[model samples]
Target: MEGNMNYFEIFKDVSVVFFIAIPPWLALRKYLKNYLNRAFLTIFFITYIIATLLTQNVFPFILVVLCFYFAIKMKDNFEVLYYLRPIKEKKTEIILYCLFFRFIIYIINVFYASLLEYVGIKVKAQDIYEIFLNAGWIKVIFLFAMTVVFAPIVEEFTFRHILYRGLSKKIGKQLSAALTSFLFALIHYNLAGFVSFFGIGIYNCYLYEKYGYRAAVVNHFIFNFISVLLILLIKIFNIPTVMT
Candidate 1:
């Protein structure tokens, strides 16, 4: 295993990933222009990582809530979700169907979790639980916003609207969706969350393919809401599980 990195890893390693990746990304930008803005992504990654580490205690919650507020407002007025799908589907139908897909994903996650445990994929449940102990109301509220609002808007825009639509033109949709999902999961920096989040990516892709951004966003929201709620519920209720 690689040695665990310190704050320098967040600072320098993150910079290296982009600085090295930039030239090829720019060269390919002519092809995948709409997929990612090179400048914005580099800025976003750098700013986000540094800010995330620095703002760890509580203030970041305030910023995330702001992101949620703006996302909801834009989605309501601009109809960004409507434009990204097939020619005829209504946003209402897309959201409902997406929830249906989200329910299915929850079942899949449970089964996969069992399989991982059976094979002795040891993960420190207590470590994750401690993050919750540090969490106060601000963090809880932020978790809700992160799940039910912010994630839906950002992830659907990233994976469904941008990643899938851009890549499918070159590779087939099948390969593009799978690869994008894998990459998406890999970026989250959690060993235990990889499978469940990858499952999220696949389900989000399906929602996008079947309907549009509306469907994808709705599914993403449902998945996050459920996951966050479960974690909160376990801790809140003081259930005697391995988590703490």
Candidate 2:
């Protein structure tokens, strides 16, 4: 019975990603190169309605829509898709910088967790981690794709590339980085993770400024890959540990 329930939960999660997430994402990517047209808008609204009906939590969809909206506005001036360019050089430097940022993020998480615990607030694993805790191997692999691959690309493009560059034009780099970092932390909807996310966001903004779009994406990818690897190890070894 428990096994059956786990399968059902996995099916539901996969359905949400397939039905609620992928179509709109693909549409946005397709239409992003060209000017905003009727076909793209139609598909977006259709997906929005379907997503809303499928899940009460429509915040993430709305957030993505907003990012794309801004992205379209900035398309004429900026190469909005420049983040997708291949990073052909500085492979070793990017990896080293990613490791440095990952260490800093870990420290931020530890400090935040300690502060919360001091105030009698327990820091628990994020929802994704909880899903991993109960998920079978198939579900774990699916989640690995979502977390380590899909999420880093979408998020780095949205937050570090589009949002950061747009804001930098109006505000100074420092202020823009701070605001973007706050928004990035806010979107996670996890209070326990806010500080860590904010720290990483700031680091990503620094990378975007110093190294350019692909470097920031690489850093984000490395960050998420480590977390997924840790989860895999825990599940394989049946190790007891707190994710947060």
Model-by-model lDDT, in order?
0.59, 0.72
Query: Residue 176 CA error for candidate 1 (Å)?
Result: 0.4
Question: Where is model 2 poorest over a 10-residue stretch in terms of lDDT?
Answer: 52-61
Quote the positional error of residue 59 for candidate 1 in Å. 13
List where candidate 2 sits over 4 angstroms from the true fold: 1-41, 48-85
lDDT of 1 at 97: 66
The candidate maximizing lDDT is: 2
Worst 10 residues of 1 by lDDT: 19-28
On TM-score, the leading prediction is 2
